[model samples]
Target: MATSARSQTQVYELRVYEIGFFRSADVLHTYFENALIPALNRQGAKNVGVFEEMGESLPKKVYLLIPHKDIVTFQDSERKLFDDETYLKDADPYLTADQATIPFNRISTSLVHSTKEFPELTVPNSAGIYELRIYESHNEGALKNKLRMFEDEFSIFADAGLNMVFYGKNIYGDHMPCLTYMLANTDLNDNKEGWSKFVNHPRLEEIDVHGGIQR
Candidate 1:
């Protein structure tokens, strides 16, 4: 698909893997780095992001970000993964691991539709710290208000030097009425400075009218 066309129709799949104590995460990382990402790339998915939680939080978590051309591609890609001979072969170690030796304790997945204002995912050129944030609302109406708030404040976010990677409304997953977004920064100091500017920005007072959106 053309870049512009794909951008407008893109959707994201965010997968979180919970790794148990005493269990090796290498199996999971190997699968993602050596198999799943390459297989997805061949199937036209791009900019797949694999990340691990910072510090020593346990159970440790691994995050996988997959961007699809559209809903159809998202639906079709799962079946295609199993059908791909190379993927199947490459993913064998993780796929065939014994239950007792499984890498992750559980996995949670969320499906998000690209927001009207930020309809595509942009991969950063250099390595940086990433923050994934989810905002939950009281109800669908409240969620709409929150989304509108985001749309209006996107410019303020940029003006504050925040590097937004992606923004979307959650359509499926644990949080019923929520939106998720990611931000990238060279370091924690950069993030702090950006937020400082954002909160103090005059534009924020005007757009901050929407209330009760929980983090």
Candidate 2:
């Protein structure tokens, strides 16, 4: 857990929407781009990210990342959205759609608290390919050790040329005892190169052999 006061720390909401076959994602994209994101920004959340899967797969998935000031804001998000006339009007198409026209088959959401080292979400000035990774541990103790390992190795990520976006522990989600983080790179090659450096770094090797948590 972060040392920062819980009230002051930021929280993130990760949402995955599953789109069924033959369903168009157009409505979902429109709602996110034109309504949800704008409404969230107005309510103090920032750097809300929307992402799609890279390759063809059954039941395509869309990922939404929303950073909130704190848990209170997250808890009240639905009410705030519903109360906003502009949001309601702009989101009508998706919100009022019947089952046959619904954009997504289902939605899965997770809430995470920012880690002590990475307390806020950083949005790069230019767009790039983003990667989101989740690490799951078997138990709470192992999760704590994993977080500590990250805290100790934080600088190595940047040193290896990886753009660290945000790191957090899952506070409320399907996967228990897990941590998630995201990275951005110029492109696929850039991503591969950065991670290559990361994996081969001596510091990472030392941590893996000596300081890493057994999970």
Candidate 3:
């Protein structure tokens, strides 16, 4: 668990939406821009991030990264957002859309605990390209080792010029026994270069020897 000046660490909600078509995606984009973000802000949530998956394909995916003070805030905010008449009216377009024209085919969510190394969630700059990486391990031992690598050797990413926003273990989500993190770069070239450096970092040699590397 991450420790900071505050006694409690941040909790994160990762929401994944799978859209069925381009029109549905459009509705979703407008909903986030006009309704959801504003509602979340009203509830005291900050650094909320909305991202579309990289690499073009039909049935597009959207990722929402939300940071909360704790589990209580995460749980209460959604209920409050629903209760707000303004939010409900603003979001009604998407919420009341015909079943056949729904904004997403399905939605998945995950709860996360911030890592000790990076306890705060940061909103990536608009000019930067962000990469969200999910690492899965086969067993608990391997999972622990992978996390240890992140906590102890994540400085390698910084040394290589990649800006890591946050790293955390997903307490609840599909494909359990995994961890997730986000990295951002102002230029795609920097992203590529930084990752190349990270993979070859000497510290990773030790992590790999301990079976931390995962496909």
Model 1 local distance difference test score: 0.86
- The residue pairs found clashing in candidate 2 are none
- What local distance difference test score does each model get? 0.86, 0.85, 0.81
Better of 1 and 3 by TM-score: 1
Clashes of each: 0, 0, 0
Residue lDDT tens for model 1, 1-215: 01334447478999999998878888888899888999999999999999888898889899999999888999999899999999999999889989887778899999999865688997766547998999998899989988988877788878987888888899999988999999888888989999999989997776675443432
Candidate rank order under TM-score: 2, 1, 3
Residue lDDT tens for model 3, 1-215: 22355445678899999987665477778888899999998998887989887777877899998999888998898799889999999999888888777778889998888865678776555546889889888888888878877776666777887787878888889888889888888878889999898887887777666754553
TM-score for each candidate, following the candidate numbering: 0.92, 0.93, 0.88
Task: Compute the lDDT of residue 70 as modeled in candidate 2.
Answer: 86
Off by over 4 Å in 3: 1-8, 22-24, 124-127, 206-215
TM-score of 2: 0.93
Worst 10 residues of 3 by lDDT: 1-10
Please identify model 2 stretches exceeding 4 Å from their true place. Answer: 1-8
